[model samples]
Target: MEAKFQIFLILLAVLAGTALLARRINVAPAILLMLAGIALAFVPGMPTVELPPELVLLVVLPPLIYSASVAMSWREFKSNLRPIILLALGCVIFTAFAVAAATHYLIGLPWAVGFLLGAIVAPPDVVAPLAIARKLGMPRRILVVLEGEGLANDATALILYRFTAAAITTGLFSLPKATGTFAVIVVCEIVFGVAVGWLSLRARHHARDPQVEITLSLITPYLAFWIPEHFGGSGVIATVACGLYISWNGPLLISSATRLQGIFFWDLIIFLVEGLLFLLTGFQMRLLFEKSKAFPLEDILIATALVAIIVVVARFAWVYPATYLPRLISKRIRERDPAPNWRTVFVISFTGVRGAVSLAAALALPLALPSGEAFPHRDMILFVAFGVIFITLVGMGSGLPLVARWLDITRDGRDEHRAEHEAEIAARREVLAAALQSLDAITDDRRLSDEVVKLLRARHESRTNQLPDSLDPDAYDVSAAGTALTRELIAAERKFIHVLLRDGKITDETRRRIERDLDLEEASLSNREFRKIAL
Candidate 1:
């Protein structure tokens, strides 16, 4: 127990330190975490950390999937739904088959087992590379397509994996049966998830305290996963559906306070989980090689290289047609969306980084079959999956900025902000119009103060007149000034409270009460800053 505790502490410390260093140097933090883990493996007397396969699939995946879904833009996701489906489902299936053929021909694995290996590495993990892409200021449209693909591909790949494994174990392969089960799993999981999300939101409508609402938000995803999986449905699909449903309704149902708090909470959770996953990948890689030495080192390296190359090439093969074919076939699509240039498609094709999901699936493979025979090349599959993750995540993540520069893909920042400001200006005008009409209706009431009504109307009119026809940085500059003023005021209040305590001018209880109010004021200002930055 003591050793286990020590190991946990060591892992956490390394993860935290490496993550900070990565941020300082402006590289993907996951890359540094993996490197640190690899270095630690060579250190003398470092304790081994083992992650159970079930723990990852059951515990780690739900919140990551749910949090992402909650934050995703459903409108944008729907708009690009066709391309997303093509990449997420079609590309994943194609890649799996392509990898399977390579593995069977070159590595001499059976068809079912070869395909199982393919499914393990099929869905590209977007968590690491997506972060890097966002930092590089990639276009929003491309980011949406990439993020949407990551979310949907996992469910697709896992379903294929399960079917392939079943065939290997039982020697029964039926395309129709697999298709039927796949449909049932998706439909049932979505239905179950939607029902859970609706109930959770209804409960949230009555809750007043931010703490209570936050707790409910945390449990909602778990229940979403557990309920569906318990009834023979895909937990991943259920969790994602529940998250999307809640995300769509949360802005309306939740208070501003809850939204701010929940955002911070989930951000922290994802950071820690993602860091640990990369570290675990590094640790598992070292352990797998040591535990199983069945194949020659040269043979293992060759197989790993072959599999990694296949994964990258297969994506390129799929993405080009996926980008252009729809527009060619459907005039409606061509008329609605702009045609994507080859440069954009190239970036998308190259940035498919395999992440923790692939590692988890490989690790989760069963050790023995129904006939008590060992699963073929289980250890080799894990090693190959690790190689793919390492190659794609580190290679692509590091080189993406250079590629973007070479492609010369720059964002139209001015136009984007101009459009945003126009929308905001329009919304404010509508609200003021409504307020003026309401004030006119109540102007004759005896209970109302004429002076107060006049003051309110004048303020609204002044604000409306200040609105610009286009984006003006000066209009939003006031927020930064206000933020600075709030910070100075908070500092003064803290000092005054300390002085009061030192001089015994106020009771401890009184000081505490006053400090709490100051804290709330700071939180409100912080929330405003957060919203501004988001815009």
Candidate 2:
């Protein structure tokens, strides 16, 4: 792994550059960073770097998934949890088997190795899409589905991959045993995850300060993951469960200051982990390429294509049926929302993209068997895995915009028009209605003593044409930057104080004063955002 300080600086530069460029080009910043990392790999003198598999998978992945899941609106997640799990577990298994069979026949790889590859590529990278989707006004329903899927698919994929990889290595395949193990892994992971989350909340309850509370939350993910993995269970599942538990319990047990601070703290952790993984992919992967210098490129391409096909097709199978699952049970969903039309299904199906998890799982394969013989076709695996990532990240990256546009799924252009039209109309209506009402009531009294009414009449009579939907922009813009970030900071500081007071870090009197100050600041900030949007 690269030095922490150097990695941090590099990530900052990458983030800043990507942010600026994304604003200019109007695309996801993460997409830009991924491309930049790929480009950096081929440049001279940038030493190839390999991230430790444990660090990337265990250390980086848990918090990354947990943070995203924790931040999700629980109401939405609870409603959509079934479909998301189906997509993650059911779909992943389907893809693995489908791809495994396809790879065995088409590419002539061992069935087990083929399954391993399929499992690797099954999970989606929801982070990039979620961040981009927010700006695009993506429906909350879709966002929750994607978030839940990403948070969970790893457990399915990793467990399947582990068993399949072990069988491939030892030549001891057992379907019944693997199935049994899978069941155990699922149960243990869920139980352990809930346990860790509960304990973390308990610790926070007794903590002495907001900063300490936040730190405890930070440590919980890794702890949740390690404890489960050490016991031969799915760490991924445990961590996600823990995250959801704590998040759901947060409003009740956590100080508001701790709650807000914990979110941003985890967010930064996720950003760094995701960013560094991509960068390391650029670096460490070159070694595998060099070691496999003689591997044929055409073979790699064929395998990648086959694997990609299975991954996409599995989602279609899972989603088409899932879109209507609400009909099966009562109290399961909010309402009988219309099923996703074919166009929407097409977009959702194609959302499958191989990413960091796939790459890490593929790379984690042992180089040689217990007898010291070389792993079968290891180079081919690497080549295809890397190829899949490249094609998916870049190829699918380029296509998403086109697909969205064709489906008329984009909200940007329409939203702007609606907003602009409404603002103009509302402003006019308010001003003119005020003026006319004042004039009509004051005319008879004006000669006697109607000065105040005249002033009111002047204020109201200014405008006749007002849009019913529009509001004044002036009322919204409180800060130079939008209310989104500043308001959050105020709330966060308030949370810190709340945690402090609860944990005995601060006196109730001081805490009240600090909280009152924050409440005022946050209220003003929120008003500004509303005003900005309304105007």
Candidate 3:
């Protein structure tokens, strides 16, 4: 237990350090963390850490999915639902078949085993690619489609995986029955997820205490996930639905303190979860390497290369046609949504980086059949799955930025960003106007004192004055300069407050209250500055 605790601490340290270095070098932390884990695994005296499949599937996944769902804009998710489905459902199934065919014919694996490998490697990882894509400022729609697909694709892949595994174990298969069961799972999980979200929101609202609300927030995903999963469903869609429900409804019902504290808490939790996940994924290389001695090295290499190539080519083949063929066939579809730029489509196709979920799925494969015979090529399947993850994460993950640059997708997003900023500015002005009108009505109804009315009006006016007149580059430069000066002033104020405490002039509690206000002001300034530069 002590040794295990020590190893965990080491992993956390490496995670934090590698993440910082990755940020400094402008690379995705997932890429660096994986590489770091691999290197650490080979170090003499480094204890081998095997990532438990159940740990990832049952424990890690729910929170990651739920948090992402909560963060997603429900409106944007809805608008891009078609492409998301096409990629999540259609692309995943197509890729699985493509891999199964390629492996069965070329590599001489059984049909079920080949399909199992395909399902394991099919879904592009949600974390690594999005981190890189967001940094590259790929158009909003492409990110949405990618993130949406990532969120939901696992359910499709995992369900297929379960069915294939069961068929291999029992030697029985039924397409129609499986199809009906899949539909039922999807429908049931959706309803259950939404129900969970509604209950979670109401519970949090009633609690009112930030700590308790945050605790309930932490429990939300597991409740949404575990119940459906216990009954043989994937639990992914349920968690997603629960999160989306909370996201869309919780704004009005949730207390402000909970929102603020929950943001930091969730952000930290996700950071550690994602970083450790990638690192552990890298550590699995050592185990796979030790297991590789069981098979001819040449055969393992050939199979790995074969499966990796097939998954990559399969995505390109599926994505291009799936993107444009609908428009070519249906005028109604064409009229409603025009064909996206080819470059955007290419970026999406190029981002099919497999992640840890694939590894977990592979590791979760049963060790033996019911009759006690070894599972067919189980070790080889694990090898190929990890190989696919490494090849995609290290290969495609690294190349995504260059691909976006070559295709000039970031350049195309400039106008979209500018327009978005314009909309934001317009909304800000409109909201302030509404607030002022409400203030006037309240003042009249309450017969408020002149002093209170004047103070409220002045506060609102100051907030209005802070808005930039326009998104002109010069205006942004001036705002940036002013913000920098404001930060320096705040820093000086903080220093003076410390001195006051040192001199016994202010109590610790009084110092904290003053520091909190300064911190909020500084945070607001930083946020405004980021918005200006992000355009």
Candidate 4:
């Protein structure tokens, strides 16, 4: 067995355990994985483990992003398309330039490498925002916007990174060519994504078996990702497109069982990918440093701080202006409601937590350029990007609640949710009442067994307390529904027992024993009741 594979297995277990623990504790797992990796690297008898840079993004991202896309609701993403695009594409470009400019002068790095660093760290982590938004129980609108942004931003950032890397390697930067390349990449990515998505939907339309359908859905993301990359398009975009397309079309084509099974299977795959990716980031950072020894530690530290500030500040610049621009344009053009509110802007801005992609891109930088010389500023770029991710994610992430409180967003949101929750409960209670009384009837047996009548009366009295006045008379009266539903249950049970007996699945002795058991309490059952009463 290879040492790296052994390390990989151990890290997998460690990350999975840490992730579960973090979920239980209601905190982000990114911090836990990073700490664990660093600890493992330092521990005795733990071989210094480093993941292959080429494998980090290639092996992990397609599944992670695809799983996230699967989990997102299509309706939510569709409704907030504008804001998501602005942040994912527009804000990404803005941030890239801001960071590039800041790093260019501050770090004394060449123009291309600095911009490459910017591009590398441009997109905030999809895993981070998606996890936090879900955990915080943010509104669907907010979550969808974040999710959509995360999904799209990576494509933009990766394209920029490619061009930036090319310029640095070749020492020839053409504005016209880069612009054309950017446009072409974006268009091709979208086209590929749509095509793949359409294919997924087509596959599901023809699939009949739940097992086969789910297996096909599991395969869709990788196919979408690899195909686009193969064709010089954005794999990330292709994966997202396919995931979104399949999910949207699933209700139309896929069976209920297939959707349910796919959710669980894909969720597990995502958990594994995300957990392993973060852990790998920490270890890989050390490898980049070890290989790029010419870069001084102080230089790396300073560059990191500079890039982190740029990333953080760039968000503020992009968010505030972009948030309001839609509203202004809407007054004349589309004439729609403006973008998010001021508080939402704050929430959105602070939610920019960098994660795996930035680290992966940094690690993916060529060890030596086409010139056969060590990649200039490669160590610094990786170190700074990692630092940006760590500080922004841990620093702002830990303080998110505080920021919300400071803006008075948390308290107001809590109160609103509380009221909304109470209303939902009230509504649900009404529904239950209606569902119950749906089975209500006027009893014809005036001389019904005294004990049975007395039990029925008591149950009816209990129903008044449980069922609110708003409920119609035919509402969720348990006793009434039970009276109607219990007979079906009895018939099913009789059939089951009869089937067993006829098939010799049960013996006469066993039947008698069961009959004796069931004869004692005659069950009180309902339409949905699936179990049987034993004698």
Model 3 C-alpha lDDT per residue in residues 159-179, reported as the tens digit of each score: 999999999999999999999
- Tell how far residue 98 is off in model 1, in angstroms: 0.9
Best-to-worst TM-score order: 3, 1, 4, 2
Off by over 4 Å in 1: 412-418, 421-486, 506-535
lDDT of 4: 0.73
lDDT of 4 by residue, 161-246 (tens): 88788778888888898789778866776677778778777776687777877777767777888877776666888788777876
lDDT of 2 by residue, 1-535 (tens): 3575775687678767766887898876666776777676667876666657777787788778778667766677777777787888888888888888898998788887888888877777776666665565544566677788888888898888888888877889888998998888888888888999899888998894799998887788889888878877769988888888877887788887776666667667776677667766656557766856686767666777877766777778777776666554554453545566576567667777677777788778898999899888777777777777767776776577777777766553345545644675566566677657656766665664467666765544532311122334442332334456766677688778878888998899998888877776775444333333411
For model 3, the run of ten residues with the poorest summed lDDT: 526-535
What C-alpha lDDT values do all the predictions have? Answer: 0.83, 0.73, 0.93, 0.73
Best by TM-score: 3
Report the number of backbone clashes for model 3: 0
Residue 196 accuracy (lDDT) in model 4: 78
Q: Give the TM-score comparing model 1 with the true structure, all chains together.
A: 0.89
Candidate 1 local lDDT, 1-535, one digit each (tens): 9888888788899888998899899999988887787778767887666667777777888888888888888888889888888998999999999999998998788888879989999999888778887887677777889999988898899889988987888999999988998899988888888888898888887897789988998898889987776665558888878888888887898887787787788899999888988888788755866855877899888988999999999999999988898899999999998688788889889888898889889988899998899988888898898888889888877888788878865443234544655676688788989989888887865567878888989987975664543344555566566677878989899999989988999999999999988988787566434123223
As for lDDT, the candidate ahead, 2 or 3, is 3
Best-fitting candidate, scored by lDDT: 3
Indicate the worst ten consecutive residues by lDDT in candidate 2: 462-471
Poorly placed runs, candidate 3 (over 4 Å): 530-535
TM-score of each: 0.89, 0.77, 0.99, 0.77
